[model samples]
Target: MEKRMIHLDETDLAILELLQEDARITNVALANQLKMAPSAMLERVRKLEEKGVVKGYSAAIDPLAVNRELLVFIFIKTKDSFANDKSARALAAIPQVMEVHHIAGDDCYLVKARLSGPMELMEMKRSKFSKIPNIISMRTTIVLETVKESSHISIEK
Candidate 1:
């Protein structure tokens, strides 16, 4: 895939840093911090959104509280060639599957999934994964502990 570069200035970087720190920060508050007028701040943020710099805002939920204590990374080998993303799309369609990446190496895809427990994982393997076409094999690795997990990206000048 081809990459596109979007130009960003110091103000844009500042806005990104603040937004990354707290997405819930109000437009008025964000403007105040940077000493920018609320309307100006809004315009800049909107332009960033238009450029695809700011994807979207979302809340971070606790996995344990939602009965999704088990986190697993499943490496999948598919029968399809590199040009095909059908298997990857199918895996991503599963609600339990949080992320699916078309990968390099022996495996065709890397899937990050959240499940209740071992029994749930087994059930998913049998009921869910078995239905996806072209999936030849799957090797799952369960995460015991997560020391650091964040989606934040630092914006440097």
Candidate 2:
């Protein structure tokens, strides 16, 4: 993917900040808060979406309610080169796997997975992950408690 610097004005920043706080905020309400016309606010939001500054919005689900109470971060060491996407693609294909990061040092990939319990995690490892090619080893870490977890990024005021 190509990386480029996106120039954002104060209005754009403000809009992003507001959206970050409440993704479900209405266009009229947002415009009212920002003291701008609703149409103008809509246009700005559209521009933000087009520029890829604003991604799609969705409701945040409670993992416990969904029976995905266990949050596990697995550090994966693969037989393939770090640049290879084979293992990453395979991991990404799994529905339980949330995020996959190609990292530095001994570990090739770090995967975030949600499971019902320890038994389900072990079963997933034995059935799903173990079937994937080029996996050398894996180290799993379970989260005891979530101190902070948010997808929002800081926007200039």
Candidate 3:
């Protein structure tokens, strides 16, 4: 899909803020909160979706509940071209890989992964990451504690 810029008014920002806070909010409830008609609210949400603003709704799960207690950030340096590298795609393909970003400076990519424990991390490094070609070096940092981690963004009203 082609990405294009879309101008947002105060209402659009309000809608985004509410959705970010609680995506499961019904159209009627949302419209009530915004003091707008339900049909108008629905249309706004539809436009947001069409513009790729509201990508998709998802259930937020607790990592600890799922036995994924360890959060590790790995900085990967590659010998291959940084742009459109197959290694980055391979890293992203891993089930445990939560986020992958092409970064500047020494590292080509910064990868975030959640694991059950250190053993699982070691296993992943040995079995999965080691096999990806052009990986010159990988530096793993285990997060001892997360002060705040959220996908939520504050939209100005």
Q: In candidate 1, which residue ranges exceed 4 Å CA deviation?
A: none
lDDT score of model 1?
A: 0.93
- Per-residue CA lDDT of model 3 for 1-157, tens digit only, reads 2668789999999999999889999999999999999999999999999988999999999999999999999999998784567988899999999999989999999999999999999999999999998899999999999999999986665
TM-score on alpha carbons, each prediction: 0.96, 0.95, 0.95
lDDT of 2 by residue, 1-157 (tens): 5898999999899999989889999999999999999999999999999989898898889998999999999999999875679989999999999999999989999999999999999999999999997999999999999999989896656
Candidate 2 regions exceeding 4 Å error are none
Candidate topping TM-score: 1
